[model samples]
Each structure stands twice: as structure tokens, then as C-alpha cells.
Target: MYTEKVIDHFLNPRNVGIIPDADGIGQYGDPSCGDFLRVYIKVKDGRLVDVKFLIQGCPAAIATSSIMTELAIGKTIDEALKITDDDILEAIGVLPEEKTHCSNLGAGALHLAIEDYLENRKDN
Candidate 1:
């Protein structure tokens, strides 16, 4: 069963889109598993000024990704990088045991995005 927060987020997912000029973009998930997610971020002054996501997944995946954006925005890159699957799971309340892996979707992609940003920064 899903929690109220989970259902709410799934039903009305937030930050569900793409950032064309994203400072960083990252993807996570295996095609064979059916859940794939892409996270885009805009960083300004070492902080995440904006965040968005696109996902091909179930309710849990959508909800997790939705809440992750809320958690990451306004956070410093260091702070955002610290976000974890457990953090998102906590913020969203609960996910079925079988769906728990979905918690990784957002945070994983987010970390990768930050890494991408750092990599791109180094090249410039």
C-alpha cells in the first residue's frame, strides 16, 4: 500500500518536465527493468536554483522523483549531493516493500547530475 504523501505526489507530481538549459542532466534505471528517469538541474552560485525530472516508471518512481526536486532545489551542491534514497523515502512517507527500489530513481539521477555539472565546470 502507498501512503497519503505518496498518492498525493503520484497523482499530482511536481517538477515533471525538462530543463532545456540545465546545468546538469543525469539518468538512472535499467531499460529491462522498465523504470528509467532523467533529472535536470540548474545551479547558480553553488546552489540548485531549479530542478526537474522525466521518468518512465510507476507511481512510486514518479512520486519519489517529484519530492526529490522539492528537496534539492535551493540546496547547495554539497547539500543536494548528500540527499539519499532514504531521505526521499522519508519525505514521501512510505512505499511498498516491492516498490522500495523506486526510491533510488530520483536521488541517484540527482547525484549524477551534480557530477555532470562538476565535470562540465572543470572543462570550462
Candidate 2:
């Protein structure tokens, strides 16, 4: 079962697009599972000025990806990096135990995006 927040997010999916000039990009998916996620971030002055995501997955996956972007935007890089699966679960209000993977994927994808940002910054 999904919560109202989850359903709302699923239907209205936030930040569902791409950043053409993204400062950072991260992707995660399981070929066997058929769920793919890509998160794009625009950073400025060590803060995540914007965040967006493109997801091809289930309801939970879509909702989590949507929620993750909302949570990341306007956060400092360090603050966004600390976002966790539990935080998403709490925000969404509910997710069946079996679908917990969706939340984990959201958190992991965000972290990976941050990692990519930091790495890219290091190189530049």
C-alpha cells in the first residue's frame, strides 16, 4: 500500500526532466529489475541550487525519485549528501516493506549524484 503523499507524488511526479547543462549526473538501475533512475543536479557556491530526475520504474520508484529531488534542492552539498532512505520513507509517509527498495534507490541515486558533482568539481 502507498500513502497519500506517495500517490500524490506518483501522479504529479516532481522534477521529472533533465538538466541540459547539469553540473552533476548520476544513474542507477538493475537491468533484470527494469528500474532505471537518473538524477541531475545544478550546484552553485557549494549548494544544490536545483535538482531533477528522470525515472523509468514502478510507482514507488517514481514517487521516491520525485520526492528526492524536492528534498535535495536548496540544500548544501553536505546536507543533501546526508539524506537517507529513512528520511524519504518518513517523507512519503508509507511504503510496503517489499517496496522499501524504492526509497533506498532514491537515496542512493542522490548520493551518487553528489559524488559525481564532487568528483567533477575536483577535476575542474
Candidate 3:
């Protein structure tokens, strides 16, 4: 039901916690799928110096969230925004068709986090 990469990430998820002083935070969930993903970002000089997640979901959701951080960290905000669901699927290598929606949780959250960061920055 899971690929080697998927199993590995699920078993030992990366960026698996929160950033207490995060510069930006975003969450995404599909109630029907019972997956909820929250992402946090720390930016410096317009680069994503750090990224983290707190996830309540299946193995696929956890794996996607974990992999998303690995792909996004160190990227500039513009670059991060360019990360798409296909990018995530390719990074993970493959995913079950039924679980594909899990792939979006990470990208969606990252996008929202960046948006939140940008919006708040504009306010001040």
C-alpha cells in the first residue's frame, strides 16, 4: 500500500515538529480524508531558512508533509510557491491513487504559509 520512500518517510518523518517563533504558519485539511497538515516557516533574507510541520493524518499525509519541507527549505519564497503537487509526487516517487489528495496537503500548506507571511509583512 506504500512505496519504500513513502514507508521510510512515514516511519521517520522529517521536519516533524513546530517552530515556536515561526515567521509564518499555515494549515490545510480534508475533513473527508481525515488529514490535517500545519506548516511553519522561518524566512531570512527572503529565503526559507527553515520549515516544519505538525500533521495529523495517514502515512501518505505524513510522508508528503515531511517531503515537502525537505523540498522547500532553503528556497526563496518565489521558488517555494512554485513547488507543485507533481513536484511532491515526483519527489516521493509514487503514491497510491486513492491517497493522491494527501500530496496537496503539503504544497497547499506551504503556499498558505508563504501567503500569510507576505500578507502580515505587508500589514506592517
lDDT of 1 by residue, 12-110 (tens): 999989899999999999868799999999999999999999999999999999999999999999999999999999999868899989989999999
lDDT of 1 at 7: 93
* Best-matching candidate per TM-score: 1
- C-alpha lDDT score of every prediction, in listed order: 0.94, 0.89, 0.93
> Candidate 1 has which clashing residue pairs, if any?
none
Give the clashing pairs for model 2.
Answer: none
How does model 1 score by TM-score?
A: 0.97
Candidate 3 at 101: error in angstroms? 1.0
Ranking by lDDT: 1, 3, 2
TM-score of candidate 3 to 2 decimals: 0.95
**Per-prediction TM-score to the true structure, in the order listed:** 0.97, 0.95, 0.95
Best by lDDT: 1
Weakest lDDT window of 10 consecutive positions for candidate 1:
24-33
Error of 1 at 79 (Å): 0.3
Residue runs of model 2 more than 4 Å from their true location after superposition? none
TM-score of 2: 0.95
